[model samples]
Target: MKIRMRTIGLIGYLTLLMLPIYWMLNMSLRENNDIMSRLAFYPHHPTINNYVQIFTDPSWYMGYVNSFAYVGINTVISLLVALPAAYAFSRYRFLGDKHLFFWLLTNRMAPAAVFLLPIFQLYSELGLIDTYLAVALAHTLFNVPLAVWILEGFMSGVPREIDETAFIDGYSLPRFFLTVFLPLIRAGVGVTAFFIFMFSWVELLFARTLTITEAKPIAAVMTRTVSASGLDWGLLAAAGILTIVPGALVIYFVRNYIAKGFALGRV
Candidate 1:
């Protein structure tokens, strides 16, 4: 009886989770009339027109390109910077080390709105406003700290004797990290990359303020659907559905590493 009840609960939870996604898919494949006529559990007559429109439209596709370009760059930069910072925090003690670590994390706590004007001014002076670099750099300010905290925890779990052993085997610091330390932390890296991608991908305020036509992200473009004609429900729903694809693909690829990543520092 207990097992049966548990099975029923699991099924119920899955149903609740999938129901909304099913609704969105249903709405995307549906015509305007079907959406307006009644609450639809599924579309009566399915059509791929929305998806087709997305591919054919330059504005729509541009958003995808811009979003991916910046988010990808931000992820790489975050990982590169955070890996070393995390290692230092985990392995060494320096003057004011604790204060510096906390200071680094304070960047994450800052509201983006507080820095918008200063960031805008700084980028403008550097002639980087409205460029991919601008948004990528902006995202790094927040993402790098998170990457550091996560990687630091993971690095701490690694025994210090591993480093000492590598040195005794005539391995240099760089060689030891590349061959030994990195492999052990692969799961942490995967998880960090996933989070950086997600945050930078969904963030809109900075992306919108920092970029114009040449580098506008998808989240910004989604806002334009609501014009004088009222909300383009069909197009809006289609865009919203499409937005989930990249993130879903990323999570699918990294899902296997998530548990291991979380357990890194715990042990």
Candidate 2:
């Protein structure tokens, strides 16, 4: 009886989670006229025009390309910068180490809104506005701290004796970090990369404000659909559904690492 009840509860939970996504997909396949004039779970007139527009239109698809460019840059930069920082924190004691860690966390906790004006002025002066580098660098203010915190946890779990043994064997610091230490924490790196990518990918305020035409993110592009025609529900739904694809693909590739990384941080 208990097992049956648990099974039923699980099914109910899954349905609630999937229902909205299903509706979005359903609307993407539908015509705008049918959507507004009727109430139906399934589309009355299924069409592929919405998806076609996304692929064929330059303004539409370029947003996606621009988004991927910045997101990839941000993820790689965050991991590269954080790895060394995390290693330092985990392997040795430093002055005000705890305070430094807390300070990094506080940066992550602070509202992104607070940094907008300063970020704009700095980027404007440097002529970096509307460039991929601008958004990528701005996102680092948040992603680096998170990457360091998570990587530090995984790094702490590894025995310090390994570092000592590597030194005794005459292995250089860079060689040990790349060839030996990194593999031990590959799962944490995967998890951290996935998180950084998603944050840069979905975050709208920084991406929209920092870019004009040459580097506008897809999320910002979607907002432009609400013009004189009211709203292109079909096209809008299609774009939103497409936006979720990269994130889903990231999860699929890192499915194994995600569970392991989360588990290690517990204690």
Q: What would you estimate as the lDDT of candidate 1?
A: 0.87
lDDT of each: 0.87, 0.89
What TM-score number comes out for model 2?
A: 0.95
Q: What TM-score, over all chains together, does every model reach? A: 0.93, 0.95
Worst 10 residues of 2 by lDDT: 258-267
For each of the candidates, give the backbone clash count.
Answer: 0, 0
Q: Could you give candidate 1's per-residue lDDT for residues 109-206 as a string of tens digits?
A: 99999999999999999999989999999999889988898888888888999999999999998889999999998878888888889889988889
Candidate 2: where are CA atoms >4 Å away? 259-267
Best by TM-score: 2
